[model samples]
Target: MRTRFTWGLTVNIMPPDYELRLKIVKNKIAGHEVSKLIAPEVLEYIANNCENDVRHLEGAINRLYAVTAMYSPKEINLEFAKDALKDYIGSSVYITNNIQKIQKAVAEYYDLTVESLKSKKRTAIINHARQVAIYLCKMTTEETLDKIGLEFNRDHATVIHACDKIGESLKKDEELREEINKIKDKIMN
Candidate 1:
């Protein structure tokens, strides 16, 4: 069976053997394991690179254990790990899809009949629609500022500024907030 693990911004699958390796790696990194010196950098490197299959992650952990000379590591309890992994993957997918839906809905709401929201345009209504799309994308997506900028053909800083400007206005401008809320409700439902 497979499980999931999250280390801040990154989420990945963790196999049953992960806990066993984690304990050994933790001890080794703390310099408590005699006759073995597993560097902390090794675990960090693996975590950074291993973000796919749990079996592959287990292999990486196994290699770490072998290098550290930690023989006969305990078996990991798979139940909790499996649940955590599922939650992480599900939540990540949910967030990503919802953001995409929000972007689509914003485009449709503005009635801009463009084939792609990312297409180039400079008219006032198109610009307003683009700003609203950017605002919704910012509010919903986990995409980086640079990625959002590229999506809208603007600088990352411009995306940030748009998000901030809209966010501030939404807080104090009741009519604008209401309009946004109505749009969001329409999209969500």
Candidate 2:
């Protein structure tokens, strides 16, 4: 927190609300010819259920960009929206299930709180707990990287990085292996 940059101020932006999120998606669609391709209902669906992340909206739109280019669908209706955005929206995975269980196990094993695991804190102890949680979430659950990211307020790329970091360390570190196994055992039971 000392002298990384001349200005190291961090400003957190809250995720947009329902109407603003909808407007953001609609505006994004209109920026291209996507408004023509997508039905209003489909736009509404993306806005309503893309959760509270602006990046999720961008990701959903980017995915739409890909899907429309690949399939060249006639119209992006509700069905098309659901199909195209299946990886983006909906209560597909729940907090009471795989992710929460893994976070609880890892936090307990590390003597940290589940909130700390999901928090922006990057202390060595907290960061290690989060990385382990992400690794276990990847190995144990059938959830997508994006979905796992939602639980920790991280993006999919960060999730992938955490997994890779833990994986490489696991191959070379016996103490870390035992640490991970102990956490995994906590999760399984």
Candidate 3:
């Protein structure tokens, strides 16, 4: 008896265009082919072990666009369509760095370190600075609760609580918001 292979069985094959697009993205990002940057075995491993879903491929492409936007050459006006994929997934690093920078500026302005701000030992000045730092970090960082916890040496739950408290305060505290804006401007400049 002869067995027939279903159409579904043949659909796993990737088109040449998809492979070429992957190569172009890889080269643009890394100045090399994906195969050159990652080992052939590793590539094969990902191809074999991972889901062959179009969504997954699309996600990867989006991530590339995000990285490009974050680190794009200053002179280039990153074409919108070319970068739409990246914008969709969004970015954590960009948010994290902006937060970190703002935190650093606020700390410097108040003459404190981020560690000191996060610490439980708080005078009035320390408490205020800490609150500001928490607010800015929340506003600026795409850091998840777990990542923010690691940054402040707190548990994720604590980070969430801090964010909630600070967010509430920011809504009512116009003076504090103004100060934070000034500091952000300085740091961004």
Judged by whole-model lDDT over C-alpha atoms, candidate 3 comes out at: 0.51
Model with the higher TM-score, candidate 2 or 3: 2
* Candidate maximizing lDDT: 2
RMSD (Å) per prediction = 16.0, 16.5, 17.8
Instruction: Let me know the TM-score candidate 3 reaches against the reference structure.
Output: 0.46
Worst 10 contiguous positions by lDDT, candidate 1: 75-84
C-alpha-based local distance difference test score of model 2: 0.74
| Number of the predicted model whose TM-score against the real structure is largest | 2
User: Each model's TM-score, in the order given?
Assistant: 0.45, 0.49, 0.46
Winner by TM-score between candidate 3 and candidate 1: 3
Which residue pairs show collisions in model 1?
Answer: 4-85
- Cα lDDT tens digits, model 2, 1-189, are 556764777787876754667678878877697678787656655654564687888888888788888888888875676677666554433212488888898888999999998889999999888998887776555567799999999998999799778766765686886787577557656
Candidate 3: Cα lDDT at 183:
67
Per-residue lDDT of 1-189 in model 1, one digit per residue for the tens?
233444346756554232334344454445434213333333422332333445445555554445334343333222222222332433432234344576677777777653456667677767666676677665444555677777677887877677667655654576765556566656656
Task: Provide the overall lDDT of each model, using Cα atoms, as 2-decimal numbers.
Answer: 0.51, 0.74, 0.51
- Runs of candidate 1 exceeding 4 Å displacement: 1-99, 114-116
Backbone collision count in every prediction? 1, 0, 1
Error of 3 at 168 (Å): 1.6
Q: Which RMSD does model 3 reach against the true structure?
A: 17.8
**Rank by TM-score (best first):** 2, 3, 1
